[model samples]
Target chain A: MPTHRRIDVSKVGDVTVVTFLDKKILDETGIQELGAELFSLVEQDNRRSLLLDFADVDFLSSAALGKLITLDRKVKSAQGRLKMCNIKPEILEVFQITKLNKVFDIRAGEAEAIAAF
Target chain B: MTDHISAAGWQRTFELKSDRGASRAVMDVLLEQLGAHDWEPSDIFAIHLAAEEALVNAIIHGNKLDSTKKVHVDCRVSRDHVRIEITDEGQGFDPASVPDCTLEERLEAPSGRGVMLMRSFMTRIAYNAKGNSVVLEKSRAAAAG
Candidate 1:
């Protein structure tokens, strides 16, 4: 079974907001569990819109980034939109350097992200 | 040949097993200390991200997560720079051979992004001739003076 222990998934209107419960998401096991939860949302629940709230996350490894990229693709293929907000400036640099900033819909906070959807 | 150096303001080296989880744990503690020292937010990000990528590559790609293998790291944080060296105990691959992930065709590819991230964030990145060792260096934030 997929465990959502490291994350809090809630709904804000029609959008699904996932807030990371941990300070850092770097371990393989944590990434695997998170991946399972996210994929289940897309494949089974068919949740279309996603807002990843990173207010609590301090760091993310490349493996974690890979998982996010994979999840983004899955959401897109399902004709759903995925976005993230409240990313720490340091962690946000990763997305900018990788040019994923151009690929993902990024906003300043939950209110703005939800409004965009 | 120097296992210890006082030239840099801060220096530490760890001989780590090829367990990704343990390696990250060690890095976490070191990063916390660096943060406490008031390393610039940008410099901290670059160093931490580059170190994580390099360490992961050494443990997973190089050592294949083999518990028998080991990874070595040397970290030096001076007033104006953060330098890290990572070495693994496996056959190496050519760094030049990695594809350009920025290309439209390769953006979605799962692999090869780590090398790209390291190069993007670090000011200087180089691999030893054997390709088993990598060095990442980033200039620290300018002094507030």
Candidate 2:
């Protein structure tokens, strides 16, 4: 059965980190239901660097991609940054096709993404 | 018009969440049970994708995170087809204006692909206005040519 994997949030130094432990974000099909939640965070006043750690994610759908872009733009407009770390190749391919690879700051790992700032 | 098929090959209905994100397990179980009814791989993927799109819309847009709101799904299988109905608690929108994802203008956008893909993969698709429900239909092929 598909489960809506929990997404844990934390503040690491200057970055507000979101860790996804499941390969699939949506309970059934990799679609994400957390768009509004992330958007709510991006729209917050005390915005810090946002780091998305996908250490356990192997796939993400286009809808999930939409939510990321929405948050990425929201943070950037607030003078902050959106950087991602630990994305699987299969999922990265989706990003590549959507031209998001050029739009988002994607890193090989958390250390690199955090260092890029 | 509402399209439907009644088959005893499989039957199940589950309810818990206002958001489609919460009804995923039900989707997986339905897919597996439908497979046992002789549904093909392509049939399974198509139904899975359609259900994903429908349920997400019902939960995200229909229920709007009102946990009190419920999203209901019913799956039934007959001799050679699988039918699914997904209903939500909110007022539905106009399906006429959804952008065609196949167009060059939207090929890169992250959303809007759900409705388009659902239409393409399913044999028949219908929406009930008053009920805020999306019905999906797909036919299964027989074992012998």
> What TM-score does the predicted chain A of each candidate obtain versus native chain A?
0.94, 0.83
- Kindly list the per-residue Cα lDDT of model 1 for residues A1-117, writing each as its tens digit: 345787788998999999998788878788888888888889988899999999999988778887888999999999999999999998888887777787788999999999999
Tally clashes: model 1.
Answer: 0
Any runs in candidate 2 off by more than 4 Å, and if so which?
A1-62, A65-117, B1-7, B142-145
Model 1 pairs in collision: none
Question: Can you give the lDDT of residue A47 in candidate 1?
Answer: 91
Candidate 1 off by > 4 Å: A1-3, B1-7, B36-38, B141-145
Best model per lDDT: 1
Q: Fraction of native Cα contacts kept in each candidate?
A: 0.59, 0.24
Q: What number of clashing residue pairs does each candidate have, in the order they appear?
A: 0, 2
Residue A47 alpha-carbon offset, candidate 1, angstroms: 1.2
Report the lDDT of model 2 for residue A99: 53
DockQ for candidate 1, C-alpha atoms:
0.66
